[model samples]
Target chain A: MEEVRNQQVILKDYVNGLPKESDMLLKTSSTILLKLPKGSNGVLVKNLYLSCDPYLCCLMSKSQVSHLESFTPGSPIAGLGVAKVVDSGHSNFKKGDLVWGWTGWEEYTIITAPDALFKIQHTDVPLSYYIGILGVHGMTAYYGFHEICAPKKGEYVFVSAASGAVGQLVGQFAKLTGCYVVGTAGTNKKVELLKNKFGFDEAFNYKDEQDIDEALKRYFPEGIDIYFENVGGKMLDAVLLNMKTNGRISVCGMISQYNLNEEEGVRNLSHIIMKRLHMKGFIVGDHFNLYPKYMEMVIPLIKEEKICYIEDIGEGLESAPAALLGLFSGKNVGKQVVVVAHE
Target chain B: MEEVRNQQVILKDYVNGLPKESDMLLKTSSTILLKLPKGSNGVLVKNLYLSCDPYLCCLMSKSQVSHLESFTPGSPIAGLGVAKVVDSGHSNFKKGDLVWGWTGWEEYTIITAPDALFKIQHTDVPLSYYIGILGVHGMTAYYGFHEICAPKKGEYVFVSAASGAVGQLVGQFAKLTGCYVVGTAGTNKKVELLKNKFGFDEAFNYKDEQDIDEALKRYFPEGIDIYFENVGGKMLDAVLLNMKTNGRISVCGMISQYNLNEEEGVRNLSHIIMKRLHMKGFIVGDHFNLYPKYMEMVIPLIKEEKICYIEDIGEGLESAPAALLGLFSGKNVGKQVVVVAHE
Candidate 1:
């Protein structure tokens, strides 16, 4: 085999408000090889597909995320990616095996934390599914609903950002559990995707609604039992008014308030006390132990055509910046993935 | 006993904003005596000390509180109270037994739900202790801190309304756990009580601080790990900015927002995501089963003088309206309890 080298996309500097292409630089270094050194429990892999998630925006920012170290300037920006094993010094992975995990936004990656990567077993389905449905987002939707909310059958479920990666799956999971699921999306296209594709009980374009509380009232006349909280601020306040007694809210993300200097205040949080509600915020990484269980449940659903997943694929390493930034603008229809290299 | 009677303090009308004395009226009517009927597993008691909790504000408002039935106009307002059983059909209690639970703010009450009431096991402690430390508020502090916050030794705990009934207990609990406990009270008197009587590591007057965030930083150089949230609105927003990563907020009450027509907005909640914090709201009633466990833990603390409790006792049943109104004005020193009867 030819002498191996690593190609990496590095963060030029910490971004301010929004990231630009110039904020990241692509470079190829010939100093190192792909093979894992002796005594090193690492996996050297060829990155196939890289996942672009909203949380990456915070990583790109100068501010450090709590519990997670900020990405160092002039280092490769890391995220979830599907990779093929080139060489492995880890007992869990072998050569030519497909895996997915915290791969750099580049053609190849040498991951020291092989434990973070999951070996791809169900290659019968599209391998790309590992980046979205069967990966972090899938486990997120599963745990956030089943574990956090502990939803009962016939309960009302409301999902914000409902057509996005995690939100779509949450809506579907709610439906499978015999819940009346309604979702809010930013656009008509996404609204249609939520109702038609994800099989939500009802979907509404939040942008079109004059009053969010009114829109919530229209959709949830009886009231919301389980709110899959993806967007916070006013949406959360609106949901508070529409929540049933003993309502449960699983705080997945708050995309709307992430970029702003200040987030909107929720005026109706007092409802939590009166209504006896439970609202909890969680990160998927904290619930990583559930990944294997997530795979077991999701793989069958995907194989039997019981679950449908949509991905907006951006081709090549050049499109990575736009793909990552598209999340803020709601440009991507479903899960946004950038293909760094082909098999 | 003379002819059976039901004497009640009925809410005359739905309160528009701050409740007025005219909004409630006391009426005495002969219906059923304060005696449990045959085969009825209930307790008939004369309420001695009734608590004036902030949550009662929500019930007084026309707006709906989910999972809980709102007090209808012309019906007696109910709250946590210390009572003396006149007669009992429930096997749990005998005549002259001191009890505490859901009881009307009146001379006599017929409790159909005998299971809700807890028989006062230790009368050596003040009977009024049942209205604060040994009652729902105390259990709320217990579960909200130990269970919800899951506080560790040496963690930094912040209690809002620290001189108040529940807040004082929470601060004490945090101190018992080896935490650096800081609290905010409205006045100098309350602040002194928080620091001296409640054994808080630090105490601040929220009204005196020009910048709440700055005050928080000044008091807690290291960020707060656990926030026993009682006052919401701006205090909550300020706390959001000063929270440690993975901090826990146990929302017991939101007194600041309770009286407002349009509740104040919290602009820093997005920090929840960045901090990976956990914020949960709970009712003490939901955790009532922990009463025995609470008593087991707290009774000793009180007897050993390891813990101290304070009460703002209103003189008579006639003073109940002013005592209830005093809560909104921050006039009560500690747990606001009305002494309806002495003998």
Candidate 2:
């Protein structure tokens, strides 16, 4: 049995308002045997990449949103990450096998539910890609845009928070579906990437706009047919008014409302009824059944270079806190992934 | 051709905020011909059972909700009503044919789109039902509940504004589907009627509750599986928190939002993501293709006395404005119908 020091990022306390870097602190675990105990169902793995996602804001709270448990204050925050199995008491997993799913924001973890992990079979692509285009974010955009939105060819599409992990994909997916796509981002730098890099038909810096409703009217003169709602509150209200009749809103997450004591009130919801819109919210956990089908479709596009996936890599486990906090302020350029170890 | 004085309820001016009775005034035309011209495609109808519905609030506003034309200030306000065809140039209809659909809030109207009318075939039941359980409200409730919610037996269902036209039918429809149902109305009197008359498992006066979220917890201890959202604003905000995973919200109308300059901001729409909820808003107009099928199912229920429908009827056209304004205040306990003529 081998013992080693495990570097981890622990939640200092339940977060209030926007999470500050001080609310999380780095800790190194005392040496422990890396080998799984006898008859254990857990897999001991070395975590490589950790994903910084907006939904993480929900679990950092003590309020206990129905389906999620709040993060334990002293424990390592668990999130979607890429890991290599060190030893396993789970029969389906073996030493040296690569897997991607929920893992600790640390160097190593004992995952009790190995069944929840998806095996990383395609080494042809970057291993870190598992937490980027091939992981939870990938599954979220695929299902939220393709399944929930059900976009049709030539339909007008709008993506809010357009340069983030999920919104970027949704915008691209809309284009792949032959839809006219426009996107909105908090900064003009991200707005530029949405149009020039992500292939969005039009992109705007929402912060620069005097009135979002007026901006939306200009962008979508005929009205938006599908709105991939990554931001909520006033953005949602204005978008509601701009949606075409029978438009769809695939609510991936409301990054804007996550930190507030009182989430902003979306006042234009009546426009939903007036426009006969379909707004559906989804969690990626519920739709893992489609992951295999998703990889089958998306992997080919990735290999052929037909899909343009962007990455914003944070250097190490120490960067985890700032990396996660950056998502709140639109500091990251694209998919934010924290690399704990290269191998 | 014979002519007669035709009385109308004209919009005094485009209404703002909650519509006041003064916003509409009675007017009489010098004369209206009792016969259609030989080449005209319109059907001359004598309005009988005129419906006063909440959606009319949208058309009354100067801000035109897409898909609806704002009511002309001096024109007779139009709504769904039961009428007798006095003369018809359209081949599908004839003189003395009883029909129900869009008609002016007046004693006489020439419906240019007679194709929109649903011909009244069954006269055994109350003719005014054409505006209640058999008309737009009925179609709204049926499609919104069965088609949109897509409920299964044993699902926990919640209806807001539960004593109104659409909510009442939805509550009854849930019972017919063998689901557990609860409803919220503005008054205890309406609440009792919901439980005793409409067979709801539980009913509460939302106005009486100090905290609607707490009230929802009491009613739906396990959480609501289907939400027939007839009221938006704070009620919708609270209901969002109490919905079950994969819950369905059939957004029939948002009566609370219709009158507000800035409609109440619903802060808890994130519950849509937490519960993976499906929230859809629809217009009854888009779904009339199912009208024939709806009539087949509902007429038998009426005859068998298996379904309960309550109507609040105003004796004459003079009462139309008050009847409509009552909706904003929850003044009507059931479907509100204004009768212009009985023969």
Candidate 3:
């Protein structure tokens, strides 16, 4: 068996509050073999591109997410990534077949349960898109907005974290659905990008606003029909007040509260009952059954220029920790992707 | 036109905190008319039993509820009451018809919007029952639990403010639906009433417990499948953390937060995304169209003795304000109703 050098990003311990670069360490694994054991039904993959998602921070915390296990100390952190099969004993995959799903932060991984990876069929688009617009982020925006909100033409939609990977797509989807879409971001530059690049009708820098409730009222004079909740805490409290009667709030991520040790209180939730609001939360992991259907729709949109995707690319596995931690502080402008090895 | 000595419960001004007896004044109308004018479509009714609902406190605040208008300070407080039509120019009701709907908190009221009244179709049950189990409270429990939650058999359910007008019934409905239900109340007596009388599988006195989250875990170790929310604030925050995956929270009322100048912050709402929870809020006013369906189901259950309704009765019109305000302090054991004039 031919062995190769493997470098891995290892979690030193469970993270508390906001993550720092020191929480992760780069380590070289001396005992990793290039081939799977005989009779092992695993696919050995060379990880090409690794996704830096905000949710990994949650997995790194002491709390357990419903569908995912907490990352163990001294182990390589696992997340979604684009990889090519180098060796396989699994029937569904073979050598050189491109696949993307849960993989390690190392240069190579043996995905013991090979079915977790999706075999990439549409490679005409960028292969890295499989970790983003064609993968988790795309499925999240598609299902969380359309399936949850059920928008009608001219309905008002307000997306928080509007310039992020998922929010950008949701805003574009809202525009395409003939809805009046507004977005909120952390900086004026991102706000401009939202209105100009993503086609949002109006966009605002949430940091510049003194009162988010008044800011929302100024934009949605008739009140918001759909709220794509991304940054929770005060933003959610403000959104609760500005939501129209019978409005829908699709809970995707609470980026604001995730890093906080003492999470901020959302005080105005009583408005939910007062306005008969529908607030539903979902995890993208529970919804991969629709990935094929999602690919069918988003692929054409990407080809026809009907949808736009932006990525903040990091160079190597060394840049992965900073890229992932940057999501908490709003450091990355788009989908954060790290190139571990270029094909 | 006939004149009667009408004593009305007048709200002195909009209450800032918990309502007291002095916030309302017993006023005798100087200029009163008991009959409708020529070509007027009003119905003059002699009010019987007045419903003391917790939602009236929301109207008393500066905040606005979607379906119902705020209570005016100088005017007589209005609410759902059982009444007998003494004079009618409306086509739906004639003289001597017993009706239940929105009426002034007085011995007599001119119901300008007569269609708000529902003519008593089933009087085999008590007339006061119309304001409790047969009217708004009944509808609130039925639709909020059944339609919104869509609970399955053997699911674990939890209800807060479990001995109140609506919550008591929700516990019974859960038991009937083949679900295990646990209820939380302020007093041990009410907790006993919930388990012994209402057939809740388990009940606890919230005041006796130090940590609500721990109490919920003790009662619902498997995690709650459905939560019928009545008392909001800290209880809601605790429930959010304890909710099972794909669970539902039906926001019926927030009695604990209503009287506070600043509502408590719900800090654990991010658990919604962690558990993929579905939370919906509703007002009973919008679902009156289902009155026939509700009455068909509830009236038979009442007649068959399959359902039990408990009421904390107040003596007169003078006792109306105290009874309604008592809801905030958990002074009432069950549905608080005032006997303005017995049939």
Candidate 4:
């Protein structure tokens, strides 16, 4: 039996507040057996691309673990990734098959539950696309905007964390539905990308604005009809005040509140009553059934270059920590992806 | 034509914070003609029972008014009430018809839109029931609990302000659905009424509990599946933490926050994301279309004595201000009704 070095990113300890790069350690000692052991049912795969998502921060804390499991200190941190099967004892996948789903943050991983992975069919698009635009973020944006928000033509829509993976797509989806779309990003550059590249009606850097409610009021003078709540806390408070009668808020991720010991209080929830708003929180895993329907709509747009995707890529496994950490500070311009291998 | 002196409750000014009895002045200056004016399209109604509701506090504030109109200074305060049509110029209403809908807080009122009034057909039940269990509170509790919450059999249900007008009915409705029902009130007396009269599985005085979250966890060991949100603020904050996966919250009113200049901020809103909670705010006026369906179900319940109703009646128009003001202090137990006339 032959073994090979597998560089891995391990959670150093349970994170207390905002996750720092030092909270994760890059180790090279971990190795993967070249061949599967006797009676093994797992598939051995080499990770190609790994996603750096905001919700990963929630899983870092030991206290919050209902939706996702907490990252153990000594083990490789796991996340949604693109991988190529190097060896397999599973019937569904064979050697050289491409897949995406729950995989370890390592150069190579042994996927015990091979059925959990999604087999890649389209080789025309970049394989890294599996980590973002075609992955969990893609499904979330589709289901949340279309099913939850129930966007109608000419309605006013707002998206927070508007330049990030899911936010960018939600804004585009709103625009495609003939809705007036506005987005909020942390940086001026990301804001520019939202308006110019994503074709949003208006975009603003929330960090530059002194008052979020004033910023929302300026963008949505008639008041927002639908709000895609990606960053909760104060943003949700401001959006609640600016929401129109019969408004909808799809609570996807509250990245701003994820790292806090006690999440910030939202003061304007009474507006939920006054405005007759429907605010619902949903997870991507719950809506996997919509993936086929999502692909039928989004694939043609991607093929025709009608929809645009912006990605901020990190080069290697060592860069995963910084890429993930950058999410909190809004350092990444678009979808944050870590490329572990070129293939 | 004979003209009679009409006693009225007039708003002194827009209430700043919590409303006081002095904010509404009992004036007897107005007079109404016994007969309708020629070429008129209105109904002259003698006010019978005026409902003292917590949402009136929202109307007291100058800032909030989207669906309902705000009361102007020196003008009569308007609300849901039971009235008798003394004279009718409208085709739908005749003389001596009992009706309920929007009416002024006066001894006699000339209702311009007689079409807005719902004619009381069943005289078997108490006439005051038209202002409460058969009126706005009834429809609100019915629509909010059944239509919005989508309660399932054996589901754990929690109602805030459980002994109040709408809450009491919602608790009973949950019990009828074969749900595990628990409720909270400000006083132990109301709590006892919730458990004994309303048939809630358990009840607690929220004021007694040092930690509301703990109190909820004690009663709902499994977790609350449906929450009828009447009083928002810290209680809502606590409920958010105790809500189960895919919990539903029908937000009817936030009485606690209505009086405050700066409303209390809810801290555990993030639980909505973790638990995949669905929260919707609604007005009974929006669900008026469901009233016929509501009456079809509730009239039988009332006739069979399957549901119990409790009212704290205030005699005469002079006690109107005290009754309305008492809602903020939890003074009047059950449905607070101010009787202007017996017949």
Q: Which sections of candidate 1 miss by over 4 Å?
A: A1-13, A20-45, A64-76, A85-97, A108-116, A119-121, B1-12, B20-47, B64-78, B85-99, B103-121
- What TM-score fits each model? 0.87, 0.97, 0.98, 0.99
- Candidate numbers, best TM-score first, in rank order: 4, 3, 2, 1
Cα RMSD to the true fold for all candidates: 4.1, 1.6, 1.3, 1.1
Off by over 4 Å in 2: none
Please say which candidate is ahead in DockQ: 2 or 4: 2
| Model 4 spans > 4 angstroms off | none
TM-score evaluated only on chain B, model 1: 0.94
- Cα lDDT tens digits, model 4, A1-343, are 8889999999888988778888889998888888877787999999999999887877788888358888898888999999999999999999999999999999999999999999999889988888788988888899889999989999999999999999999999999999999999988999899989999999998889999999898999999999998999999988998999999999998888887888888899888887899999988799898899998898898999989999999999999999999998889999999999988
Candidate 1 CA-lDDT value: 0.86
State candidate 2's DockQ: 0.82
lDDT of 1 by residue, B141-166 (tens): 99999999999999999999998899
Give residue A18's error in model 3 in angstroms: 1.6
Please give, for residues A1-343, the per-residue lDDT of candidate 2 as tens digits: 7789899888889987777888888997545579988889999999998999877867888884637688899988888899999999988999999999899988999999899898999999988889878988888899999998888999999999999998889889889999999999989899999999999999999999999999999989999999998899989989988889899999888888887899899888887787888999888888889989999999999999888889899999999889898988889999999999988
lDDT of 2: 0.89
Question: What DockQ results do all the predictions give, each relative to the true complex?
Answer: 0.50, 0.82, 0.79, 0.77
User: Given the true complex, what DockQ would model 3 score?
Assistant: 0.79
Model 3 over residues A1-343: C-alpha lDDT tens digits? Answer: 7878899999999988777899999886545688888998999999999999887887888875536888989989989999999999999999999999999999999999998889999889988999889998999999999899999999999999999989999999999999999999998888988988899999999999999999999999999999999999999999998999999999999988886788899899889998999999999888888988988889999999999899999999999999998887778887889999998
- The residue pairs found clashing in candidate 2 are none
